[model samples]
Target: MIPTKLIPRTAEASEPPLLIKSLLAQSLKYEPQREIVYRDLFRMNYVEFNQRVRRLANVLAELGVKPGDTVAVLDWDSHRYLECFFGVTSAGAILHTVNVRLSPAQILYTMNHAEDKVVLIHEDFLPILTAIKDQLTTVDKFVVLSDKVYGETAPDVLSGIADYFSGEYEALLKEASSDYDFPDFDENTWATTFYTTGTTGNPKGVYFSHRQLFMHTMGLLTYIIGYEAMPFKGSTDVYMPITPMFHVHAWGFPFLATMMSAKQVYPGRYEPELLLKLLIKEGVTLSHCVPTILNMLVSSPAAQKFRDNLSRWKVLIGGSALTKGLAQAATDLGITVMSGYGMSETAPVMAVGYLNEQEQQLPKEDQLELRTRAGRISPFIEMRLMDDEGNFVPHDGHSLGEIVARGPWLTQGYYNDPERGAELWKGGWLHTGDVASISPDYWVMIADRTKDVIKTGGEWVSSLDMENILSQVEGVAESAVIGLPDARWGERPHALIVQKPGYNLTAEAIKSGLKDQVERGELHKWYVPDRILFVPEIPKTSVGKIDKKRIRSEMKEQILTS
Candidate 1:
């Protein structure tokens, strides 16, 4: 450690700080001519992209945005949101990526909580804004982002809020000069913030600094480029992000793609047919999304229509675990599917299930094993599991413990909430709250969230493990397993399974299949759920992970009473 007396020296000559703007600047230098495509409606090369970014910055400055001011945006994964990522932050203001999927009450809370001074709304989301219009206290200006899929004309839907609207995104940029000096600031200043998907109560805020996001971008690139076998190709690959742009900056792909000058396609308000069309038409090679979105794509008629185009695509599944059944379906379609693990608290890319050279040589059937685990932890993240008593959980491939991580890119804490923040950063590690184990070779496999583990007769069983197995049942479309109260055993599992159309899977048939797997030693007798219910659909959170909390509350008495 250095001497304390020398630590506070602003006079230090060699302190080279990292900046987020550097990512854009570096991209502009080399691939300024690379294409940035927006759903066939808008297209621009990096040189023009830079001009748009600067113009957006000038517009914000004209609207009285200053350093440290919070500018919030409510839009889909579009080119405009991409501009805000750089322009707002480059101008030294904080970008609040508001989750438009939240209830109107939640949206009102988040905007006011962030004290957002300016709001950028997509024309589609205008009604949502007006519905909560009077409740918005901190928003001073609203810039409407056009939602025209294939036209230059703005939507006429803003008449309801004409008094609330400030200007249109295109017109404002057109009026502003493309020359504004974005002053450099300490990279530790806040850059972006968004609320967690929030299963429990009110949504909590998570934030990242410029340095943190830049470091995350570097960490992500380190593995994506370093691991040549990563599902998504680098630089030359066509990139699309099915994850909402407001969700962890679409897991930071926009920044990484911009930095690489990769061809980017933004499919606004993702429709299965439209996304499939763009996937083939634009030759999109890589994208990331939750499993539900992928399930939607593969289940659509568009998938069959564009079957030949599926082989060229690669997808990273996160926000929830990827089921083996889903992996098999993707494999059959010739789409490369892999699992990734992280939370909203992480700059959200911690690990990706990528095979190494040796592992890649294995048969395709065996490779799916590697493709389904939480995956190898990415570069620069220190991860390990700890037991219930806070002792080290040995990496023996069987011991389970809560997954915790420490990294340069991990959030410092929940923004402005010190109590939860301290708990999150407890024991000097950013507690991931996910339970997982590591193989001897260091491949990480997340079993379940800490709270979701099932305990029966003093034995811990993974709820995720059961759901993963049940998902493979022929007629099952999706599954959710929850440990319910049992007087005989502490808690036994109850499962809710959604069936595919034209298939009626009875509870006995499902149990019989599970029993066969148990006999084959693939599952434990206790691991078999005590009860299974076929449902039309399983409830899901906003970002499309299973909503067990809601299910447990809704079905507990019925299951117990039965």
Candidate 2:
């Protein structure tokens, strides 16, 4: 075996660590005047934003937050939260962006598991904190974030635990100096932590180091900027994140946008009307979200008025599969829509849909088909499909297998659960648990989640494929397909659909539509759902993916009772 060579460092050599603070510094140097807006409440440039971040670091120090301490943030998407992305990590503390959408018990479980020492909570979530404050083992201080001013007393909801209150967010920052010297630390130091929104047990903890996040940001920038075929995102682009910041660093775009010095907008809470208003008023050019939020935006009555302004928007959909129907709807509005694929464990981005020059010349419909796929493997990412027997599957666009990936930025393991961590990285690759196929040209088409794929009569059926076909059907608003127990077949596919307003859709009509797909060879005969149930809504996880586990459970109960 050949010995690996090593390079010795000189005493005078300056090797600065790739830290989160460097991103802020680069943004200030490039475009200090670029605006960072927070839902019409506040607006500051990169310079001012940098100052607030420094003040936040100083405040943490005053609150006795030492390096390696966990500081949890419970707030809507706002400028303050953006500051914490850099402030807490740059100061050497781990920033735990608490998913405020989780139930009270789940939220408490995450906080306690993380052993959060300080909490910066929004006023709206005071009741949740009030309910669980007694159970919080390590938290010693609380800082309130609010749009309104609280003079001397805390809000009514904090009546019982006001003694634990440190101060308000703005008040603490104002008191702290804006020029603390942020110390440089090892790039491999853990910078941020959050819990995954799993369906079964307590959410698993995922943490990232400074180097991992920095590289993730750079990897996404290389794809978005280096490839002209990809969605247009540049320094001049006005960026807003519809995806909650709590989720995988908002897919790591906040850091990328900051590094590029793009104008940033943070919509405080996701209101359809407010998001639309911000799109027009702030001239938001680039954004990313799940399919449900995009559907809500395009289908909203408020969006009808701003169609002209929104025509220039470019959206990257992820956190779930992007159905052809939803992609077409967004495209019809002149919005540039594409899909990407990742999970909570992969630092959340491994591939994004883009068309090469040759493929871009194809018909619009063909292009849309490619754009809605899971996308090609991203730069610096090594991806392969492994069959059930652990052999590598060919990228023939037909053979299906679970997607496993190896990348510099992929999470090393779940924070404190070595048993699950070992399972996640069983073969030196992160198992994505996604059933998919890769084309010869490296395009990834996700068939279904490993657990969500239906096996009917020993034939596999992709729920995503079925739902995509149903989405194109007339009068179908949104759809979800789950496997139900069967007597003869191992399992049968059942679809729960949300009908469009003013359309009286029936099971027969939907079946007839899918039958046409079968004739056209677009769908397998067995892929058609045996039962089409019309429902008002489908349950969603905290991050907006369909809750198939929940749907499957409910249907099993109904079947037994019937």
Go through the candidates in order and give the clash count of each.
0, 0
> Each model's TM-score, in the order given?
0.96, 0.97
Query: Candidate 2: lDDT of 115?
Result: 91
| TM-score result, candidate 2 | 0.97
Worst 10 residues of 1 by lDDT: 227-236
Off by over 4 Å in 2: 150-157, 229-233, 519-522
Model 2, 1-562: lDDT tens per residue?
6999889989899999988888878887768898999887789998888899999999999999999999999999999999999999999999999999899999999999999999999999998999999998999999989877534554443676687998889878888889988899899999999999665678999999999999998888888878743555555579999999999999999998888778999998899999999989999999999999999998898777787787789999998888888888888888999898898888888999879989989999999999999988899999999988888999999999999999989999988899889989988888989999999998999999999999999999999998998898888889999998899999999999998889999999889877887899977899788888899998898999999999999878877887
Residue pairs of candidate 2 with colliding backbone atoms: none
Q: Which regions of candidate 1 deviate over 4 angstroms?
A: 2-16, 149-153, 157-160, 229-235, 560-562
Error (Å) of candidate 2 at residue 39 is 0.7
| Tens digit of per-residue lDDT, candidate 1, span 351-444 | 9887877888999888987899988888899898988777878888988889888898989887778988998888888888899998888788
